[model samples]
Every structure is written in structure tokens, then in C-alpha cells.
Target: MDDKYYTFSYKLRGDYKASPQYFFVGTHCANEFLDITKHDPLPLFNPLVHEQENHSPGNSPSSSSGDNKRLHPFNQELLTAINMLCISWDIIPKSGLDKIITFTRRRSETPNYNGIEWFNQIVGKDRQRRSLRIMIDQLRENNELKDLRFDESNNYLNERDIVNNIN
Candidate 1:
């Protein structure tokens, strides 16, 4: 029998007080795991779903006025935060804000997609997720986003106080 292992380490960009560094290690077989010859390549990220959702019932031509309505404040703030964090960390590039905004707008047009899941997909890989998680943890530890708390009523982060904090 043969055995193999993979190990990696990474650091967050800024001076976060909670945790400054991170490391990870895992075990797997090169033949079974690293070998992707049999698997299909990942599909291109598609915006078609967003397009379709925009044309759906409540948002159809007859109700075009709905397009003028603003996205929920909480969701808007969350996307802004994600964009800011990603750009600060250089995860997505200078256009990260545009990508985040486009993605968020698409998701907003679609009621069925899970926002958290969509976020995870955009981050795309484990390393990025780790970096983002650390940043969020630091933010929570420092109470930077104290105004954005989970609301029991809506089962999502409350954004009533987030308006003043966004900048």
C-alpha cells in the first residue's frame, strides 16, 4: 500500500488581533485524489441563471417598476463588506467589487439561491475560504460589525444599524 499527504500554510494580509497566521495539512493518495484524468473540468461560472430570474414572474415586463426598488439593505451591506474584504486581501483583483456587485445583483434577482452558498462559490476554493473566514472571525472578535447581528425574526443578519457603519 502507498500513502501520501498534503500540507499548506497561509497568512492574512492585515494585522488582525485575533489570529495572525494559519496552517493546514491533509492526507490523500496521489493516484486517487490528484489524478483528475477521469473527471470533467469545472464549468465556467454562468450568469444565465441570473438573467432568467430577472425575467421571471414578479419581475417580468408587466411589473418592470419593481426593477427600480433597491435591494434589501442588509444584503447590500453584506455584499459591500465581502467586496471590501476580498479587495483588501487581493483575493479577486481590483475588479473584485464589480464582480461582487454583479453577483449580488444576480442573486438578488433570484429568490431561490442561497446567498451564503453563492458567496462560497465566488470565493471558489478552500484557501480563499480560510482567508475570508479568518477575516470575518477577526471582525467579529473586534466587534467591527456589531451592528450586523443575526435577527431571530428574519433568520438573517439585521442591517438596521449597518447603514451608518458602511463607508
Candidate 2:
């Protein structure tokens, strides 16, 4: 199948509209997929006491929770949807998993979906179809992903790639 079919763009709708945003999820577009995942904040699943550490450049995780109540709920459903797509495509790296867990822990303290209107826009019928198509194409391209197999399930792909390159 042509790789172009796997790429998709969705319109962001709201009282304040912006230009259309595109996302690609496929074996050949790992970087693009990571770019999107990295930017999209995941919901904080665990309640960590190191609220101040999140803001600090290099602080211990053992710090006390300061103003932890500020954490608000972002588009967790969207994050999960993206994660399932990543898993289906075997694109998720350890960094991606860490991002999922940490982002959920840190960003959940102050959930902000304003920067990611596409999360909400994806709920629409048309946009949902487009997103699902992208995921479907990714699954079709990777046989391992078809059976729900993950590449380097323990270690993250990005870190593993970096280590292999350095070696």
C-alpha cells in the first residue's frame, strides 16, 4: 500500500480556530508519531508528592507535594487512543511509556487541553474516521503489530536506538 494513505490531517474546531494539524502513524513515520506524542500531555495516573520537582530543573522525586491540587484533568481518553495506536504500530519506545506515565503524573496536576484542540476535535465522526484510518494503515504495515506484538517491550525504542548507535 502507498505510504501516503497513512498520513492524516484533522481540522481544529472551536470559537478560536487554527490551521489544520496533520498526524502520521506508521512504521515509516516513527519520528512524526513521536513528535505528536511528545507534545500531547498525558493524564497523570499516579499522585506523586513531588509537585515542586516537576517545575524544578533537577530536583529529587521525594519532595513534598506543593499545591498539587492545581492538577486538572486533560484529555486522557485522547492519550489512551494515541497509545493504543502506538502499541498497534510498535512505535512506542520506553521514552514514550515514560512520557505516558510521567506526563500523567506531572501534567495531570494542571491539565491544559487548550494547546491541543485536536484532542477534542477527534471526537467528531469525520475526524474519528480519519484517525482510525491512520491507525489501521499502521497495523496493516507491521505484521507484528497486527498480533498486538510490541518491539522491545521492556526497553524504549528511542533509548535502545541511541545505545545501539553509540555502540
User: Which numbered prediction scores highest in lDDT against the true structure?
Assistant: 1
Q: Which 10-residue span in candidate 1 carries the lowest summed lDDT?
A: 40-49
Stretches > 4 Å off in candidate 2? 1-73, 94-101, 114-130, 133-167
Tens digits of per-residue lDDT for model 1, 39-144: 2211111111233332222223223222454555545545545544653364542233444444656565443224433443444443444544455555566444
- lDDT by residue for model 2 (1-167), tens: 42221334446667234444556554335435535555322122211222322432113222323423343334343344445544444553232343453455466655433322332233223323444435545555643332322223212323434321100
Superposition TM-score, candidate 2 onto the true structure: 0.25
User: What lDDT does candidate 2 reach at residue 153?
Assistant: 24
TM-scores, each model vs. reference: 0.31, 0.25
Error of 1 at 46 (Å): 29
CA lDDT for candidate 2: 0.36
Q: Alpha-carbon error at 122 in model 2, in Å?
A: 14
